[model samples]
Target: MRRYAEVKTANMLMAVELSRRSKGQLRSYSLHPGMVATNTVDKEALWPAFRQLDIVTSDMKPKENGFERWKTIPQGATTTVVAAFDPRLDDKAGTYLVDGNIAMKEQVASHAVDPVCCLLLE
Candidate 1:
């Protein structure tokens, strides 16, 4: 996803540049929903393995308590809404977001940041 993000960033930058040249006001942004109890996390292949380990080593059940410890859909939507409408973010362009705040940049996996993934973003 890193590669895809990088490419998407580039694409957003280009779009912003075009908008600027046309004397238009616009902004670009990105968001992350941290530890959201979404299908992507629950249905992942390793989730069962992780849950099995937790059963033996921890008291929490994966479905009932493990992943649910994090944010739900509404909680996750806060960041998305903030990025979309926050006046403080008006001057911020191509900002990566998480939890309604700027996300710290991190090194993405090589595969995630590859040219192929970048194209996928387009």
Candidate 2:
């Protein structure tokens, strides 16, 4: 989660810089699709953690899990698709998105608003 946050911070910084450099001709976004079910469990090294989480949270799974029990591939693609093609978001530049909506500013890091700090990360 820390690494994710760091990457998101860097991404937000890049988005801001790119947006400025492009003179409003570019739109960049950082986003997460929640816990989507993918072959990562079998192909990557996160299976042990995922398996343990599943065992612990199985009874707490909600009906909105995206499929019979877990998040589907399509569900994971929704936010990316929206961020890329949503006309309603024409003015939303240098933003973080989650579940197809703009993420709260507080959810991003302070560095995201500081070009100097953002550059330091690079």
Give each model a TM-score. 0.50, 0.70
Global lDDT of each model?
0.56, 0.67
lDDT of 2 by residue, 58-106 (tens): 4333334332345688988999999899987778776778778887777
Tell me model 1's lDDT, rounded to 2 decimals.
0.56
Model 1: how far is 4 from its true place, Å? 8.0
Q: Give the Å shift of residue 100 in candidate 2.
A: 0.4
lDDT, model 2, position 109: 63
lDDT for residue 103 in candidate 1, whole number 0-100: 59
The alpha-carbon lDDT assigned to residue 72 of candidate 1 equals 81
Instruction: List model 1 lDDT by residue over 2-102, tens digit each.
Output: 55467755654454454344444667665566556566544456455556534212433234454335678899889889977888877765556668986
**Superposition error at 40 for model 1 (Å):** 3.5
